[model samples]
Target: MPTLVLDTLVNAPIAIVFDLARSIDLHMYSTKKTNERAIAGITSGLIELGQTVRWRAKHLGVYQTLTVRITKMEKPYFFEDKMIQGVFQSMDHQHLFEEQEDGAILMRDVFHFRAPLGPLGRFAEWSFLTVYMKRFLEERNRIIKAVAESGDYVCYC
Candidate 1:
């Protein structure tokens, strides 16, 4: 398994940042390059605990469908989503939010995932999947930060 962690700072309210992080619309917009879309379940709006979402997207030149369920949520502070069905053997992503003294919010993402195919998967992770996933998360966080700081997050949330 590989773990990827990232922290993004946003000059916005924690609640707004958290909401945007779980917004289906915002996620779809952020991943437009991959043509990612919510194909079933909670297809739009904010995803809550126990809600599952099925996403269809093009990655690595192939189209894949992934289903994830929000396993835990604590309002504007924390949330956890785990993969129910996807290409990976297992995937868990934790979103944590902390408010700064300056009113900014620090959004941290802790992602853990394992690839299939045993040794071949290990090689993929060591070679490019890790980097690809990191870049993917970074791009998503970048969009979330931009939307949160722009005061236009209300539309997505």
Candidate 2:
């Protein structure tokens, strides 16, 4: 398994940042380059606990569908989503939010995933999947930060 952790600072409230992070609309906007979209289950608004979302997207020149369920949520502080069905053997993403003294939010993402095909999968992770996934998460966080800081979260939240 490979784990990727990222911390993004946003000059916004924790609640707003949390909502935008779980917003389907905001996700679509952030991943437009990959043509990612919520095709089923909580497809439009904020995803809640136990809710499953099926996403269809193009990655690495291939189209793939992945289903994830929000397994845990604690309002504006923390949330966890896990893959129910996807190309990966297993995937877990934890989103954590902390409020700063100045009213800003420190959003953290911890992603852990294992690829299939045993040794071949290990090679993939060591070669490019890790970098690709890191870039993907970074881009998503970038958009979330931009939207939260700009007060544009009203549209999605």
Candidate 3:
């Protein structure tokens, strides 16, 4: 398994950042490069605990679909989503939000994933998947931070 952690500071309220992170529309917008979409489950609006979303996207020149469920949530503080079915052997992503002393929102993302194929998979993870996924998450967070700070997140709701 490969684990990735990312932190971003947004000059916005924690609630706005949290809601933007879970907004299906915002996710789609953030991943426009991958042409991602929520095709099933909660296709739009904020995703709540116990809810699931099926995402269809083009990654690494291949089209794929992955289903994930919100396994845990704590309002504007934290939320976790785990993969129910995907190309990966397993995947879990946690989103956390904290209000800083400066009143800005600090957003953190922890992502863990394992690919298939045993040793080959481990090699892939260490070699390329890890870096690739890190960039993917960074790009997504950049969009979230921008949207939240600019108050454009409301347009996605």
Candidate-wise lDDT, in order: 0.97, 0.96, 0.94
Write candidate 3's Cα lDDT for 56-136 as tens digits: 999999999999999999999999999999999999999999999999888999999999999999999998999999999
Q: Could you tell me the C-alpha RMSD of candidate 3 in Å? A: 0.7
> 2 or 3, which is superior by lDDT?
2
Q: Compose the digit string of candidate 2's lDDT tens values, residues 1-157.
A: 8999999999988889999999999999999999999999999999999999999999999999999999999999999999999999999999999988877789999999998999999999999999999999999999999998898899999
The positional error of residue 111 in candidate 3, measured at the CA in angstroms, is: 0.5
lDDT of 2 at 40: 93
TM-score of 1: 0.99
Which regions in candidate 3 have their CA more than 4 angstroms from the true location? none
Worst 10 residues of 3 by lDDT: 148-157
Report the lDDT of model 1 for residue 154.
81
Among these predictions, the greatest lDDT belongs to 1
- Candidate 1: where is the Cα deviation over 4 Å? none
How do the residues 1-157 of candidate 1 rate in per-residue lDDT, one tens digit apiece? 8999999999998889999999999999999999999999999999999999999999999999999999999999999999999999999999999998888899999999999999999999999999999999999999999999989898998
Residue 24, candidate 2: alpha-carbon lDDT: 95
Candidate 1 or 2, higher lDDT? 1
User: How are the candidates ranked when ordered by TM-score, highest leading?
Assistant: 1, 2, 3
